[model samples]
Target: MNDSDDDFSRFAWHTAEQRAAQGDSRQVADLAVELTHRIEAAAEQTRDHEHQLAHLVRVLAITPGHDSLTQLLRLFTRSQGPGVGLAPRFVASLLAEHREAADLVGPLSERDPKGRLDELRICLLHELILRGVDVDAFPKTIDWTRVKYGDHPLVWLPRRRSPLETRVVFPSRAINSSAHPGGSVLPKEGRLDPPTPRTQERSALVDTATLDLHQMIVSAPEAGGWGHSEAWVFRADEEVEPDRVPALLPTLPMGCVEGLGATSRFEIARRPADEIWSLLFATASIGIGHDGAHGAFGRLWAWKSLAALSDAPADASAEEVEHHVQQTTWFHFESDAEWFCNEIFADYGIAALSPDRRRIAVLAATATD
Candidate 1:
């Protein structure tokens, strides 16, 4: 092995040996947490992630518990989906032996889980279940096997008005302002909580996971240029009352939208649901495709995100998502609307009413050069 690899391996094992010899559980745990950042930083700098992660997993497997695992997840709150590279297999394997490893799940609001670290955590959670973690171990709120509300966000299919009329799942991460180009893009108190419109279910069991698209968002070098990611789900129940389908949603940007107001500008008219979701997947950059030779990581996240976020079965497919979307009327926001050319919103976005007509999932994104 190279000098750096030897250094990494030696440092991890030596530290573990020293801590274990001293019989200090707290020291071991603290070192475990510290190593995540150290190894992660080394991996990023040397671009040698696989080997680094293997060593990290080896080191952490010896020190298992609720705190270390919980802290490990907190690291994902800011990741952008595919970029975070810890291997889920090792973590899952460790969790299998330690019953308490998956005990705590960070609040979704805390991390807003945009990348693969969250995905990896989810895969570990699912694997832990497979490894004998009790099915009852997870909260009733997070049904990893079921895709609730709609795809991409909201694991449970709560009543339509809930997210809109409920309390903020996450504290206002930011105050509203036109200067930052508000709307569904940046986090607001009433806006759907980060990752999904979680007005009603802000307290998601322990507040945790799901996301992976059935179709790929034909990727481009600049399509998902570095930027912020946001998603929301709103519902009014198509099977209910006197036509209040579009439920008054929070402020929305006008890039993909044409008119000045949100009400009638980006209207829908029943198009193929999957087609539109492809657009959302593209803009949201769900399941990024950059994984060396293992095909695209998007496909992996599709099922992993599903398993991680809900109780929905592992085999949930795109057709089913379409079945739900097609049940309503969906349409695309054209490129000819009033502010369709706005620079801020111009990066990317998908504003379509779910096929149920009872909800609208507004996903807005911004890209920087």
Candidate 2:
């Protein structure tokens, strides 16, 4: 099919997989059964009933749990008359009498490899965070080999020969924009510098003790006609400890400071931290796919922003929350610099001053012109 069709199919498949992954097995099963009936009904009108009937049978066979088995049998036995042949009866008998159907049909054992890997990574990271493992230590515990090369056939030989050597190695040093700031297409002027040694050290400490740190820069409207922006950094599922924050503030690279602190003129208000560690983990794992590669820093920053602000609802599923964060981040990045500065800061309770006596006439002329 065409690219758009392929995309739509992939999206639908992913959506279904996501629903199934989120412990909604019953809902998925029900939907599958409903679709099977609809297809079967349509097959009756068409000349190619055999293929559609077989497809329906396959659907029933694969559906998990005893409830699905019962539904399958009921659908088969109820449609025994007329053109409905011995195939349904045979399948129904096999399902009803023996354990073969039970063995064949069960909960989803296999899944999309990439999706499964993502889930495993998120879970692994969550467990590591809970156990107070250092962020630096993450590279050691998780199998990057499986993540990067396990599924690809090209590296299969090397993986089979020496899995350790084949594994993708993450750099020991903090990601530095000066060295490799990701894709060439990215705007260099807006890029943040690499993490300083001090920042890296503190980040490790925070990761080991609490949660991962994330930083984002947004332009903020200032007094006069000019707009200035500063980096807003915060930890996932953590509050800014008044005593500790001051010392750590300097560790960040130049122009990288807490958004609230700078906007409130260093008089930031106290807010309790939200339990959004899962949301953070999900967002970080699903980075924005750019230049055929995903940037880790961007994902982390998005995660941190969502977590720090407690933007996701507690009841929302992990997939839903991640989608929301990603959509918001994409929009923010796409917005004009000035609009983003004014809107985001204001939403987060940061005050921006209106332009003073400096240029109403100029502004008026510019607006009119």
> Pick by TM-score: which candidate is best?
1
Count of clashes, each model: 23, 0
**Root-mean-square deviation per candidate:** 19.3, 23.6
Clash pairs of candidate 2? none
lDDT of 2: 0.30
Could you tell me how far off, in angstroms, the CA of residue 309 lies in candidate 1 after the best superposition?
Answer: 14
Off by over 4 Å in 1: 1-45, 48-226, 237-271, 280-295, 300-319, 334-346
Candidate 2, residue 107: Cα displacement in angstroms equals 4.1
Candidate 1: residue 333 Cα off by (Å): 3.7
Residue 248 local lDDT, model 1: 28
Winner by lDDT: 1
